[model samples]
Target: MLDHLITHDDNLRMVPTDRNELAAAVGHLQEELRALPEGSDTARARVLTRWIGIAQLCLGHHDEARTSLRQSLELAVTIGNSRAVVATGLNLGDAHRYAGDVRGADALYRSALITARYHHPELMDFALQHTGKHLMECGDPAGARAHLQEALRLRIAKGDAELVKSTQAALERVELLISQADASATGHAVPGQWSRQWTAWLQSRITTRTPSRWAQDFPTVRYAVAGLTAHQRVHPCHLRDQSFPSALLTAMAEEAEKAVAADGYLHNGKWNAATLDAVSLFVGQVDLADVVSRSSGLAVEPPHTAVYIAYEEGQRLDFHLDEFGFGEANLILCLKHERPAELPRASTTVFLTADSYLECDLAAGDCIVFDGALTPHGRTPLSAGESVTLVCFGFRAREQDSRTVTHLPPVPSGRAALGRPESAPAPRCATLCGHAGN
Candidate 1:
């Protein structure tokens, strides 16, 4: 499909697609501009040229985008369209950034901000959104957040739902980056569900990796562990036949599907789904954790959870270790999956042991409990039209080891730990989810 480069409220945005489509678009746009009669409206040509520049930018044709944007700006000035000038300037700044001229991008962003702030107050959000994105690209996510938050506030106040969403998405991207920065600083997982007071925690996102270059070239399945590994206490079980509350998992799966598909409950680049009904279910339901603890052979207290979903082609999780605390043990509930027809044995949660690899082809409401931090595990890639929604609960393997500890006063664990819902006839359940990561 041909990607659209649209201007809304004098701000530039693009629907991204492949380079061939964008290249075709630039060619078509150029032909259209050339077909305009001599002395035809410069304004029309200005818009076309700006679109061409954006298309080229998306195609990674930096010099071409910059040239087209500059030409568009000149036309805007010729037509005395100050709003277009400011808007086109933002694109030009992005071009400069792509061209590795950071100083030029910064200067243009500052100028655009000052002009919009004092002269065109209606365009404040446009200037701020563009500048915030530029700042984020320049390694200043905190600074970016302030600008994006204000832009979001303005867009919301203006009551344009689409504009509000666009800004909100941008803001959420920055928030994820900010969360990543915090994680890097602390040498821990991102703190969405994990508490700061806790010494250890697990996050639902995939691995944060520093790959050994040689290992990247090789393809070996078997791996060995020399350190403290997760001791196998409970066999990896697939609970069905209503033994694992399949009805509840089915209901929760519906809610989780909605959360991921409509609400956007993903981390990393895929973050900021609205926390809807399923989130409330996770926050309030204690029986869920109890079942996980019983099935996994770990006596865990109540646990907090985060979610994961993959929407793109070939999205996968590489093997890696998890942080302590929240990731010590985890129950990964497979809410949904869209396995591709072309790839058999793909897009499943696969874990590695010393001698062999274990692949869990999980369906909805089917969960696997394991030591996430200790096991080098990952989900394989998805093809086009493939997706997966997963919810993860983090807890400790032992009941007494589940307490949250820090410099402050020691506090008990979270709400309702390890309470079975009386579904199974047995008194003692299995272990907790030892594998902590998603």
Candidate 2:
């Protein structure tokens, strides 16, 4: 569909601007939105509205796109659509940029980025690219490079050829600027101390911690895993006491580490079966029930689990909570590249629980737990590679349901010594089944 749109969209793009093809598309989408039953899957309506925003943007209707995107974002939020929010945020920022408000555009881009960090690292590539472009436009090539590198990492994971090509083009521009800065006394394009400070502050707001008290007030958790069982070895440039994979975390970690070592980007980056397999591996590790409960303090029953994966640069899943059946427990896990940080905190994991919100700073090898039933969850855009995570749902079981429940191994004495409640934690041994990888 995207390919078709891209080729055919040129015709639409070529239409006379005065004739207003955007309004026609907007009208068609509005009709679609109106025809859907009130409260019928909002996802569809949101998606349609997103297309309308795209059309509006392509047709150079920045104001219309902004209006439509705002409405779309409101609907997404109403429907608990995180992906939609991210999409709308991106569109809104783009509208601002095209409308010649770079600062506003940057702010909106940053907001979208902050939202994306919580869901999937895959879409962060697109968000990063756009944000990087914005940063470059704002005279911060270093920040642009940082985001572009992340985007490139995700795209490499996804094997997205077009994105890699375009992103490389952008990177080349930044590289040239850096080179020029090095060669000329007054041409230093790298960010100054103040820009670095501001960027760091912005990152901390999104990746390191909850941006606002409101987010902290409503907490949710994301659960993800990889069935990595082998030890890989690596000398740590930062950690003095331990080398990576001197004890391996999992076989999967080898893939991740390899990608990271290669800087997590592909040369040609054409989306291929291998990239799909990587995404599958990522989702296979997702445990939605565990994510929801740990983050929101909610309980999930057994017998209902589901997972989905998105692989396109623009492909996205909207924000939503499973309110019916076994979907009560939900969470999202993002497989993203690790950033080099002195503190080892590279990612920000947001837990949206009922009446509470918590964003935890994370890095590779760290895990976050949260409840999904109490709060809604979804990813932004998958800009680079396919973002993978398991989405498991557990249903309340009846007394007559005679399923054998495998118990967790007894808590080690040392763990018990850490003051874990014996009876309270006993459920892990019997009630919640530990994963035996496929």
Candidate 3:
């Protein structure tokens, strides 16, 4: 019933009703118990162990609590203390009940009941009440009723109005269920016994034609689509927090560094450099492409691919998209520059005509993609320094019409095409049809 404030900030609070939260609380309390000095005080240990056992029971961590409380109970017995032993036994029984071990709970309750009779009558009453609950679970309602009724009488005699009221509510529900079951066993008919009458009555509640809004309001479920749409355009500047595998960037950088040093100069369009070789790992992580595609809404097209490599300072791209005709998305992966570069401030700028231009100054693993249709986009001139490299993948539909030309030539007959009039373009129809007049 206790609501704990999990955080020290005074605002973060949680209830123990949630299973995960209760389990976490048990873990926290265990840590606190472990911090206590060994043998500091047996009474204090007993108190902490009791609460810990209860927390574990609520969390459904029964075996863990049983182990903890059994040890504490053994210590209490060695000290000739009945109070702690009796309390721990009652808690152990509770844990057994929660784990659906009715017989084990009954044995523990019986032991606690004997100790409670001599040491504390209140605890004896508690044990009896729980024993009755176990009896009910074990399918002995008569025995359960006897124990529960006696427990209820004891509580009333002790003048505990709260316990009496609670016990009375339980007794009433048991009696009501028993009576209804007895009545149902006789030759009397229940409301739904007449099958034909019941079916007609239920059918009257239904309708052949329901409201159309019901169909719209309750939509059918659909699986997740791992692609992007070009219709929902996104700016290239939005991918500031994209995370990439670290090993990938290191391998790519090492590859690129090896290439430039070996040849005295790096060549364009050839990924043979050490950097490009390391790009395969990034490409292997298909989920990253799905994330980018969804964010950018690039049309689901052929060649779902991505490339990433590290770019040291002084590297530059002249401006080009992949060989794929339609440029859907370009992702740039960048790493932070440790120091400034030698040639002009190292920033990649895409020149989209004179009026509209875009510049990207990226940190490590940052990615962005844009539709090539929106003014030509490219990076700025690179200087000699640490800059980020990106593997850009362009996607297109799996299948596309091979015809490159948009316009069609005049037909030889000039007759109406199949399913189209002669006035319409030949491309609109698959083929032409001959008419006698032609």
Candidate 4:
């Protein structure tokens, strides 16, 4: 009877199988296992239970899947079936992850990874891929990249074309995210010295091409008429007034430097690539707010101002649209660059698609305004030993009438705001962090 039920379960593994058929098959196998005397055939019971769990998972019954998988895992351990234990561990972890039990999922994945390393190489590959996917979603791109890259290597060596293609697609997404993170120049400037030779090398790469007609006419194109109409807009430097008043530019730069010096750079965990270095003094102190308001034609209050400085080599910002709360109107002022001549002719480039992008070069004090929440923008990697500084300001359309007085909204000043959400139930594995069943 056990062997007949096992055959039925094996047949259900075929692809394009019907879910209803699978459920019925699982139910039939379950009934046969239960008909036998309790505890009479523990090994067969474990395998049957695991098959049932898999069927439950396919049907989106995560709770039932987890319960069945947990029982199968306990039996596998008792029977010293390391391979079954590892497989059950992975399935249980998936069930927990689907149920939003992140901590539980992490624990199970870690346990499976450790157990698979000693049991089967294929099990290890699956564990690595699943763990990497989890980390990628949890804002740990660096960690995810490491795991996925290794998993890809292993899968390729095994000559699994389908798995190779899926892993490659996942890896590409991770690489794109890393590129954007590198291009993002947010955070305070840590005091560091650049050799004169480094500065000279950067300057040598500056483009000295003659300005195009469009470039020359850029300044006259008002921001209100340009970027406000669509998701993004670019205004070239006006030929007549290519720069802001020298005093205002100097003051803004000085304030930026001072803020970095005083507060140090702040790291935002959401995009693990860059940090927030300095913020502009409020509306009353900086004239840039008025400039942005006038140019964008938004009844902008004093903007949330911040200075972003790129510190790492090969760092690039990822392409992403901003959130509405950041502002309806966003302005980026090019305050400083390593080579003035190579400063892009526009603000940071905005991408229309993965393969195409638009950029504008602006001199110090030259600013571009766009619908911050809608534009997908990012920067390229800075050359070795080179750095760029940008002052970012956020503004709302006047009619929105938001009461947000600061760019970084303050956390409510009470204990209620500090409460943590309840965590998921812990995994049953004894040592989730270290070697399991070793």
Candidate 5:
């Protein structure tokens, strides 16, 4: 009976469209489990329960799926089936996540990641990807970037081009959010100009001392320090000299054009006017981690890269702060800027204070490095017949703690972790950008 049930369930999974067949298969599995004595066929019962949960999830019955998965997990634990435990945990997490229980979903995913790290290294990618995706939807781009970057590294190491492409796309979405957040904080209004004497005075004060020392020297300005610890502090922002080689810039620009043609432009809404993915190859080829480390005075890792394209008629980026994780430091390389000869040149501006802003009209191949997470910056909107393409690479400080780090307390027993099933209607299926709970 167990063998027949397993075979039938497998068939149903392969051809999931037939609701009647799926219902019949689930019924048979439930009947078989019921006929067996308690604990008599634990392993078989676990398989049946897990398959039933999967079937329930596929049919959009998330509550039933949760119940079945909880039972399946309990059985797996009882049998010491490590592989089954990991698999069931991931599925259960997805069900919870898609059902609008972000905290609950994260709890499950963290557990799965811990389990996989110890017992099933092969499942690490899946655990990370799902967890990252969940974090991204929850408005934690930094956390999402950390996991997604790690996942991308693993995929690239394994030479899986398809997975690499998908992971890269996910990272791009996170970057767009970070840019938008920074724009919102800075505001779109044109800032007033500062006198040259004022600019020189501020530069002299900061250039001669470390950020921590500067804070101490100017105690009154310390209140504006944003959020930097003395021990691992660096300047809030700085520009690097000739960061990108001319040839590399040209290659990156070509790559961006190709990607835009293949993937089409992504409308990011109030964040980026448009974006292109999988254009980070050149960035990865360079020793960006080292550059960021030296420039920011913090141990940093290689960047997660993307190409941002702004159109003449597109919306301008608003002033906002970057989230902590991937936004610790960012390197933006201007690739191509084509504008009408009659219009004034456009520039990227960083707001230093209410009375002053730093604007740079970067030529092709020029790059700027800044503490994106702590500073507010945005670009002036392009004029008619103007378009600009930029290669953006974001690096995280190695010593900086990730904001998503959570202490997972021990979960109580089966179904209790999810609380009693709610009377509320099941959530709609998860969408790409919205809440994962479907």
Candidate 6:
């Protein structure tokens, strides 16, 4: 009869996110555990207790979560339920980490990661994600990125949007931390930047005179501090020193075309793929972003404002500075270029300098990294049947990211510029064309 009651209790294995719902569930489970005879059904009790512990963890009761999960973990080990043990270990590790026991958290996450790899590959991302977070918190940005990226790939393959989002958020937070650290190292660090916690870490790290294992243990942070130069604001750096992975670029171009076509853009403007959650999630990967940020000296956010930009016949841009929020540092990577004449040169010209109008013809895979806010640039009117497709990645200055939820930058008015025929109406864009009053 007692086994029957505990068996029925197994059906209450829901992990609710609501605080009130979680609290009620925790309380109910506790009551049930007290009612049960000691050692009546260890298996069922472990299952129930695991849920209770995780529920308490979600409820922000870290101490309680640790106690319950530790107890449940022992039961799982005793009963030989390795999977449950792995699962409970993850939550318990999170509890430890959150409660300021860094070493405890590190141990559990490492253990869980290894166990999940062999026993339950399905939960590998869960373990990997938490481990990555732990690594970042411990000041190892590169290791954190590597782990998070792998975890993201797995979560994406698993087709769980929520799980993917969780990993992505952690990855982004880690990326931002590296960028901020890079900025500080280059003597261009923004005073009082985003993330108080990250700022605090940097403050202590920068002043440490005694040679810590900085180069060996936290090489990513070290590289960000040593390998980069203060980024140039006026003259654009071609980044000829580094090679973008061709395979990734190929995949990105293919994905960009499909995404832009499906989500059509303004006739001669842009399609903001950053708004497309899935496409944005895939193309703007951590590998490309990390390189760009280190080279550019700006703490790049996930290219959430990334766009598919284009201009058709008769489209021209007057030289103008881009506004700050969306595009302070801009990466213009040409994806595709087509023209009626099979000219060996690029049909469209980018004026690197507005005063002198220095023209540069860019080809596919040629990326130009420049400060859009400080550099005056424009596109010349395209000849007949000429179209240029570009993928633009933009990041705001780190200190400038103090946007309130409602304080969004005004949308780039998708309007035709000065050269548009007066008879024709301004083309509306699925994205921001970025050429307005110029």
Clashes of each: 25, 49, 25, 23, 23, 0
- lDDT per residue as tens, model 5, 115-199: 8766776677678877888888789876887788667655654456877777777777766776576445544211111112223
Q: Is candidate 3 or candidate 6 better by TM-score?
A: 6
Worst 10 residues of 3 by lDDT: 220-229
lDDT of the structure predicted as candidate 2: 0.45
Give the per-residue lDDT of model 4 (tens digit) for 31-111.
977887889999988988887876777667889989999999999999998998888898788778767789998999999
Candidate that would win on lDDT: 1
* Model 2 vs. true fold: TM: 0.42
- In angstroms, the error of model 4 at 249 is 61
Question: What overall lDDT, based on C-alpha atoms, would model 6 receive against the true structure?
Answer: 0.57
Give the worst 10-residue stretch by lDDT in candidate 1: 217-226
Q: Per-residue lDDT of 307-339 in model 3, one digit per residue for the tens?
A: 333345554543332222233445555533444
* Candidates sorted by lDDT, best first: 1, 5, 6, 4, 3, 2
For model 4, the run of ten residues with the poorest summed lDDT? 428-437
Displacement of the residue 315 alpha carbon in candidate 3, Å: 99
Candidate 3 runs further than 4 Å off: 1-24, 186-438
Off by over 4 Å in 5: 1-23, 26-53, 56-129, 133-240, 243-247, 258-278, 305-307, 313-315, 401-438
The C-alpha lDDT values of all candidates are: 0.59, 0.45, 0.49, 0.52, 0.58, 0.57
**Over 4 Å off, model 4:** 1-17, 172-438
Q: What C-alpha RMSD separates each model from the true structure?
A: 17.2, 21.3, 28.8, 22.1, 18.7, 16.3
Please name the candidate that would achieve the greatest TM-score relative to the true structure.
5
Rank all candidate structures by their TM-score, best first, as comma-separated numbers.
5, 2, 1, 6, 4, 3
Off-target runs (Cα >4 Å) in candidate 1 are: 1-15, 37-40, 184-438
lDDT score at residue 306, model 5, on the 0-100 scale: 42
